[model samples]
Target: MQSQDVARRPAPSSPAGPVVEVEQAEAALVEHYPRLVRIAYLVLPSRMGRCRRVLTAHSLTQRALPRARTPAPAIPSRPAGRDGDPGYALVRLQVVRTALEAGLPLRRRAWPKRAQLPSPLPQVWGLKLFPRSGGADELALDQRLSALSGPARAACVLRGLERLPDGDVREVLTAAGVADADAALAEADRGGAEHRLLDSAEFDPCSLQARPTDLLRRRRRLNATLVAGAALAVCGALLGPPGDGWGPDGAAAPPYARNPAAQAALDPGRLTRVSPTAWRTSARVDFSVWPARGDLTDDTALLRRALAVWARPGGSVQVSATPGTPSGGPAGPPQLLYAGTVDNARVVILHDGLRIARYAEPADGTRGAALDFARVDGAGRAGSSAVVLGRTDGNVRYLTAPWVRGAGERDLREPGAAATDIALTGGVTPPLPSPALTSGPCTSWNVLQLTDGTGTRLVTDLGELVPAGLTAGRPGAAEAAAGAEALRTWAPFACSLRAVRSAGVRSVNAWAFAEQPLPDAGGSAAWVCTRAETWRGGGARVLAQFHTPGGRFGAVTARAEDVPACGAREPRVLAGVLWKSGAGTWYLLAAGSRDTVSVRATGGVEGSARGRLLTVRAEQGARADLKGTLEDGRTVSGLR
Candidate 1:
């Protein structure tokens, strides 16, 4: 009876795991070679230099496979969380252990470990290899990593590169001879390492740039240098003194070598400016048919300076662009939309079909200039209704389309507020506060009201060259943002547009998917979803909001990036939020579309309900997860 009872009991947890075959480890090492090297590179000390680190990382990863099958002592409860293969797990652990040991100081009292010395194989001659330079963020991350200790660096790499949890990290570190796993994890947490930066190209040893080692100095004795110098001398003597054409380029990308196409692109007189009546006769109603308008349209010197600055802005110029938009020189001479002296700055607007670029310079001098670009690739009549002219002090002025018969400014939050008529002088509207720059609260949002042949529409500034269009109703069949009903619907969510500011947003639409009756007879609440579609055909953002009765604004309950949860193609969305009723009772309220057959809550609070709604009584500070079954038998998780 005792023996049978002992057999029924489960085996105790062991520190050692099943041994993996050498062949299996070799396959994993070959398949995940790049990822393993990147982990090693991140764990190694930055002071080793990129070239040495790259080689050393490769060497450590290659040597990770054991000569024979051995027990893997760092197995977690779930293998799927770590590549689902014991071979991959074993190799990764060995690489991390070796990388950590490499960063330790050499002890003079005893012979050094093989990992502490420089790598011998995979060396490149006469060249220094390193990853391409990244932006400011990458530099900051590199400096932060360099300040951390060896074990701390390994902990961070495991957390970021391997995406491992603290429990697994502790197991792997302990199995690798780490004396105090908790101490390493604490040091890593205290360093405040931004884990996202670990995936950037700056730390990717696989993507590298190789520059000649001392080649510039060594090339003095080469015949090719003599020939290049002699040729340059002759060309300089024949050209004599250089003109403004060859002068210092402020901030423009220089051409590798001069060509006729590039020269024509930089010429101001070559810019295409269609006639005033061209749009009427043209077959395509795009930027190409719009006539150039402004007081300085015919100013040759001003046009030349604008073109020069547009081609290559100097170092003093501040340049920016909307998301997914390129801020580079045009392929050829772009069409001029407007050129004029607006307020204290000289402004020029250009259109190349795909983008709208605004170039602005101080009236006194071009010492301080700013260049901004926004993508408007397929803009037609309604989409191209307006372009931002000048933005100053958080105030923006717009140049309406020629077809825009009238323009006005209205606060979306105040649906009953009187609209202020904006006088157009040469088709330019006066400066008004932009929602993109509003701070502190979501009290008010100002939108551009344009009246054209198609009726009235609403557009709001999001710190871009082209204001984003606003609409209402369902995704594909949404109508223009007009009428009192549309204004009231947009009022509460108008401030939410700030989330997608400078994201190359082409349009946004708000849709009411479901209405649920609150618990304890707290009155019904509305569930609204807003989707922002960008010009680049991707990166659509969706937000699920919960609006309670008598609340001035809806609270954002769930959000997702680049998902189809609440977009045109996929209109169905499921979400839940914790709410405190006016009577001081806490409840977990959830709602979904009519298509959701049943909704359920799990974890902190448990409940199951039929149809598209679920309500559960919950304690304060409770955490829960939610899901819903669709009519088609598919399950959907709440957007996060």
Candidate 2:
């Protein structure tokens, strides 16, 4: 690049430059310029037209790339792939942050209040690595991009296109002036970019054509404006104050300077409206005292709540406080206390402690978990609360502090948690109730059980518990133990009874399979349980359980030694419970010392284990039957 080009470049401020560091930074940028350009173009298209996007992207990339700032010491050389390298990830995240910042101020232009027609698709420019355009609707994709505010759009692009995880996504979004990082993720999910992003083919960078002459002209005009403004400032300082000003103190002319009638048309003190941006800058206002109206001045809770709302990161809230007139005596400036983002800096309003509003910003890691805020009472006694903030997926987190560090009396969610929506009931006592846990649904449970052979292992799901003394060498016990383990691993445990759907009109159906990783059973064998459920009436319930000591892993191909006796030729039924909510059919079979009869079981599979397998069967009108197998191999089938 020529010396003239360097002088004219509009990159953001850099550290005091040495020749060696500058060269290295420049080299690194030039090497990955294409990738950086693509990132900026995708995120900034709305802010600048296609032609300008190219020029502006180059400028932002220069400003954003970490190496471009302080290459020698601060940033390491780019890694082979950024997937695993923390340094590379941080650098990329910085680019995203800078890009978001650059676009936030210009989002309104891209998304104008008065409806504007969408630009024609631009032609592809420097790169072709963008994904092929297919499987997604172009119009819908465009709408999704348009709907997002600048910060949310940056988050979606970085997460979907860059594949950065939640932590990185949160950092970039928070730095980009997004009020809530989780909310931004939710916005991305709603736009269908949570998993996939629009392909590179969808973006047409070259459609917007720009000439060098236009940029040169615009730069020249900007220079002229700055010069004129400087000249005016110097002239004003040199000139004497105007004699005909608002007051003798020489206060600047009001907004309606041109027309005296317009200035006097409305009461400037009583009525005032401010833009969201204006609230961020520090300023003082002399508001009207409307005691009858019962506004901020008359209500302490409302005032404190409003201050907390405005204190959120990237958040803005307008406030109007009544200033006393000469009749009430001289009014002191009301001190405004806000929670700062960089540190836990608390500003106390010593003059009557007019404003001691407390608030907390959403954050993560150890620092976020242990954050604390203090609340000073009227008597100077202080109460503080520890803040716990975390979120799953893309939603705002509402946590309750069951106990505070020093003030263990009240349960609170930091001061700012409920500040966004506050209601004052005009009672002296502060309302502090038990905090509710916001850690999502309580269905999933983790249970650890001791396996006789080795270390303790995790049981995957909830199921019927096996009786004690069921172990190896015990008749009909090892099979039962294995069956329970299998059930824990694979059965779909439903929290509510309503979740089970009626098994179609079939008499008996295999509803689910219970399978567990085998310990000593050879490479291909696994302990499996085939659960059959009965469908009658309007609901379905488990009817019989068949446990296989070791079966082929997928039931696709089975070996001779894998299946037990009952499952060898046909499906098996073990000793299991059979009950219905109302009227149902039942049958019993047993072996006795003398009685003998021919019997055939349709749905039940026979097991080889020999032990007392007790069962009960009943019908609405028929008497309950009792059956038992005698010590001898004879049959005592059924007794009613």
Candidate 3:
């Protein structure tokens, strides 16, 4: 029922010993046991387990390594077969033997000290032999290789050195490095008969393709040369002189100088003109013609007279004259002339170079009348006007003027009910009153009475009206008795009281007295009144008093709250008292003009009678000095 196809199989090689070459081992490993030790080492740790498992799995120990003298098992050869059919075991073994021989020796020679053979020796061998240096030498190598075209360089480095993955090698060579190295390496890798493929005519594909790197380098060099050439041309053009019908000097002439009309327009003479006129001068009296344009001789005489008039002490007048005439006329009369007005008439003259008329009041006898007309009342006497005429007795006379109704001249000899009024003539208006003594008290209401260097009176109540304290320095016994009685009654507590007459004056002109109240009757109080004649033919009266509380009073205390209600002008107050509770214990409080006072109880008896004290006053703000006393008899003397 079955037909057996007995296919002839090649003989299998025996396993070799440890001295077997790496090439033969590689062949055996690839053909017979592609992953034999790798699979065993994954599961076991011992070499015995690896050997046992490999031998048991392949039934190779009895067939190849029975006594270690024989070599390890080679890969069996493949049998003759149709496409896709399994080959003979003997053919696989022979192929393994061939590859092991070629690869084993190479691995041993390249790495003689390695204890164990590494897998994939051919690929590793390629990588080890390839130089990894990436410096100038590598750059030179890259350049030299690049000259052979992209495909050539790619195939040489990829297949010979990098040994890149198959897919990448194919893509890089085909897309970029289209060179014959692809066919050369492919043929060399194919075994036996296929090695002849490198010699074919189709292997020269790299020679037919353009080298992109060389093309790029050439283009860059060409562009640099072109750029340099262009720059040189531009520099030459710029450095050369201007050409193509430009001016000989190669600069345009000024616009104004090129046009005569423009130059003429800019000339100053054409823009404006100046004309000269004769100098002019004038005088006051000759109103007919000003000296500027009139008969020069007559004008000069009048001018001299006018100058004499103003030359008087404290007299002055101003005159103005115009120089030119418009319309180019024969220079009309001085266009305007003004003379000081005498009396009440302001004089102006309009002369046509020949005649003059004065529109002024005549300076006849009325000049005296005009001077007397402007008078003023004397000081403190209204309506009694006086003329300011120099007196015949070398004294100025504020001569009284007679009153007149309406706008008529008044007589200076007889004024009305008012006193003398001084008259101011010429340009003066009225006379000011002379300085005299004013009849009023200086500050206090003390009356003053003065005589012209003769006598003085101080009319104050300290004399006759207030007999409680009056003293007069007199030689008469009656006057002395009267003075003593007044001092005893008014100042009974005073320590002393007397009235002494001036030593040099037998007239009993000066007085001296002193009085102070007794300390036991409360502190001393004193009052002094004086009457004296001033150097200015005037008199002055003054009164002053001083008072202090008695020594029996207690120390004055102060607090901030009590200061506001204190009836003192300055916010701070001063307090002083006599006696203390002990030698070192005394209460004294004093504050300067601007200072505040404050106190705090410090380790003192709280409920004792001495603590129940009153505050006199305290300064209101920080100042250099503050004064206050404590109930315990301590005083704040000054800021510490």
Candidate 4:
């Protein structure tokens, strides 16, 4: 409760004491800010947590200066200290003293010190800050220091950070109001860390790594606000004049706004409706040329409801979007592709250049309306022509492009099966089957076979607003899956599309890159690499599948996301899988594209072979690194 230590040597310039001016102390704090903050951070108790310590350290250092010119303790910091400024020594001591006080616990009987309370300045929100992490040794040292008392922590900081001798540390600790400076010094010397470790960046508050706090929580709160706002707007619309709303928009709660862009997006009159004969005369073959179909296209009430819902859907609407597809409203007026009653629900399809949006409401009411979005950027001729209209029971209908002459459904599993005719009524095909919508076991994947001027290609519904095109063969030269050979190639891996069901896939291509002879005179195996290209260009997924002669379904050996491995840009691929022989012994089987000159395995099992194949004995479930050298002498790692 009492101080026993005194300053041994006062500043030589001042006879009475080290009386410092406000400007001098301010200058010292600014010049040595990082070092001073580091000392305070190390001195503060670990219980304060890293984020709080960061703010407190800065607060203490800034509050260290005297109000006016006043006398400071005439203490000599150290003999050979790097900081020769007396101002720095005075301010450093003040920072350490206040930081220690902040760590003291509040008592009911005693009022706390000003420093003990949370610092009012340097307030931070929505982010957590921490010192840059250090190596293991620094972490160990930090744990050791955390066990020490506040005064002992100050002693260690003074001795290591300021390089002060034991005597000087004792004097500083005593002046900082430690009850027993000798005991504090003893505790620090016994359990304290290596002095140099205290200087690590882990203890520095000036350098920090910052990250947002509770992002998921923030997003949930934002969504809740939007829902509340929608409810309020609906009430206002009912009570207010009819001119307030564009129309009675079903499932579309127009947000409370007067923004010009929002008004333009909600207005049905501004929607672009292409003529039924536009695609025949247009140069490009994409959704932009598709004619607006459906009997409800001329109904302004229904059209207004669809546009308003598409622009700002209510919380009650079941909104779904394929992965990587933007669910936000169109940037400007979007083109109307179709608007009509399909099955028991009224469906409307709208297309922006990047994505297609479909809105559907129950035939009875708008209570159970649904909205769906799918990315279709950069679509080409082929199967990009048809879009799903609505699904009734187990059957799905599609609104096709005007350029298409006939429509049919083909079961991909049966390569030679006769195509079943799906009669088209005003460019809308009758519901056949939707494979992506099935659950339980593997059955059949039927795709819409559209026969246009170019040729017939297959488009499969992927549980989105739009369907993805199917193709087979080597990367850049892949053709439509309508051919017998292409159909056979797609049959085995057709179920693998489940992995990328809602991944915004524009097209999927299967390529049989290699047929390798199994180890120990076993049957040959087919190595196929399949890629699902996304409309966003970046989310392509590649999988290396291995299949035996009689295997009905191929097994995926390796897979990767957002990589160009099996695409046209990078056609070469290498993959390895551990196979169990009839005798139960494990062998590492690997294969690469025909361009591969040699294959090698390392780590758990090591082997190298000329040409594109490799086989080596390996422990069961053992993992090995595989690589291949192309004919051009470039190395490629095995797909993972």
Question: How many Å off is the CA of 384 in candidate 3?
Answer: 37
Query: Candidate 3's residue-wise lDDT over 546-600, tens digit each?
Result: 2234321111122221121122222222322222322333332222112322332
Ranking the candidates on TM-score from highest down gives 4, 1, 2, 3
- Candidate lDDT values, in order: 0.80, 0.32, 0.25, 0.81
Model 1: clashing residue pairs? 250-314, 251-313, 251-314, 252-312
Report clashes for each candidate as comma-separated counts.
Answer: 4, 9, 47, 0
Off by over 4 Å in 2: 1-28, 45-48, 65-80, 84-91, 106-136, 175-179, 194-197, 204-640
> Model 4, clash count?
0
Predicted structure with the largest lDDT when compared to the true one? 4
Best-to-worst lDDT order: 4, 1, 2, 3
lDDT of 3: 0.25
Report the lDDT of model 2 for residue 562.
24
Which residue segments of model 4 deviate by more than 4 Å?
1-261, 583-585
Better of 3 and 4 by TM-score: 4
* lDDT tens per residue, model 2, 48-156: 4345555555556665445343422222223345334333333454455455544432133344211112223333334322222334465466557766765566767
Model 4 worst lDDT window (10 residues) = 1-10
